[model samples]
Target: MSFNLSTLLMTIITSIIVIVIAIAGTRRLTTGVPKGMQNVLEWLVDFVYGIIGSTIGLKKGANFIFLALTLIMFIFVGNMLGLPMNFITVHDEPFSIFGIDIVTQQMINESEIIENGHKVVDVAWWKSPTADANVTLAMSVSIIILSQIFSIKYLGFKGYVKHYFEPHFLFFPLHIIEDFSKTLTLGFRLYGNIFAGEVLIGVILLMGMAGIVPLAIWQGFSIFVGFIQAYVFTILSMVYISQKISH
Candidate 1:
């Protein structure tokens, strides 16, 4: 399996940024009017809290507040990382990072990537982590699995199984398919949007000076798309968890 170095590096960077913001935003306690970062953060927390409360219920959803907040923040930040620019490099031969061969000599010799009649490796050194299918898929899958565990914890293994047969036994197959479809669509939706945005950005950049106006417009739209994806993913995840755990 091929691994994406850019995805890893960018994910780490996104996580760091999110963690730093969390720490900085809450370092001081405020009983009065929130200011600056704290104000922004409190509003965000209430926004997420209301979404979860609407889905599962404030009583049941209280446990998931932190989870929902973290997911939304990390994903939103991760999606925004690629808006301004991307860092890419070309390697004529094998390449490595941290002593690990990311682009091996064997792959280079066998690669079909050609530019100007020369075989070479093009690597993205930085971009949004959510732009990668694997990254989004892993996040989706993990959230699904976590929901299942919570289902079991709340409903017991017998209830979990029984719910699959719900409203009837014949629904078993459909329930199985529903979970599979949810996982696939959830992951693909985020990846497709971000990756497409990045691809269009690259295309516009090829237009030279003429791209300036449209590029500016597209990036502004991309920022909106990124934030919406993050919010959608978080809210849907809470809904899925509620389906399982609140039955």
Candidate 2:
């Protein structure tokens, strides 16, 4: 539901590092046949463009390609963060960074206790931000807001308002509810998938008692899940935008 402070902090830190690497790679671009980071970035850009073009049409989707790419990259990166790191809990009171305690200890279990009674319980340093409903909801709602703006721009204010009453004025309430439901589903779907994945990985890790084989298998699967979720979210956003903007 709410973000773990450590998770949020980790998300920000990871995002910054990704951005820096991207910038560094991009700045060194050369004209003749891309290599290394340039090759990877180009491929990613082309992949996103292909998705956008297929979903929203090449012409209209061009306007939104960058948004789609950014969303996929950010979400994928956030999801990937929880895969490698582990966290511990300090249970005497709560763990705090700079005088603020962010970890919700209630959500953690006794099984997570590694050593030294309740005074300190070690856990992972960060969780995937997409696992938190608040983060996903914010992302989905922002997309909805942007969709509305595009709808108005393309349809004019009167046309945008009339969209709610399509077929009959009686359908307006249903349409409103549909909009809310879209946001809810979009947000919760990502949160649910990622959160469930994290929890499953944790449980597996515990059961395996730090076994390499199980950890490797689950982490590999988790990476695949993360990429698929990112793609699904991006394509859905493009579809939503296209629906709103197209006549």
TM-score of each: 0.94, 0.87
Stretches of candidate 2 off by over 4 Å are 1-3, 95-124
TM-score of 1: 0.94
How well does candidate 1 score on lDDT at residue 111? Answer: 45
Candidate 2 positional error at 181, Å: 1.1
**Model 1, position 166: C-alpha lDDT score:** 91
| lDDT tens readout by residue for model 2, 1-247 | 4346665677797689679757966988999999888898889999999998888899877889889988998999888987887565445445556765555654454334435554454445677878878789999999999999999998999988988898899999998998899899999999999989888877787766566788789899999999999999899988888888877
Clashing pairs in 2: 86-124, 87-123, 87-124, 87-125, 88-122, 88-123, 88-124, 89-121, 89-122, 89-123
Q: Give the TM-score of candidate 2.
A: 0.87
74: Cα error in model 1, Å: 0.8
lDDT per residue as tens, model 1, 45-101 = 999989988899999889999999999999999999998888877777566768788
After superposing all C-alphas onto the true structure, candidate 2 shows an RMSD in angstroms of 3.2
- Each candidate's number of clashing pairs is 0, 10
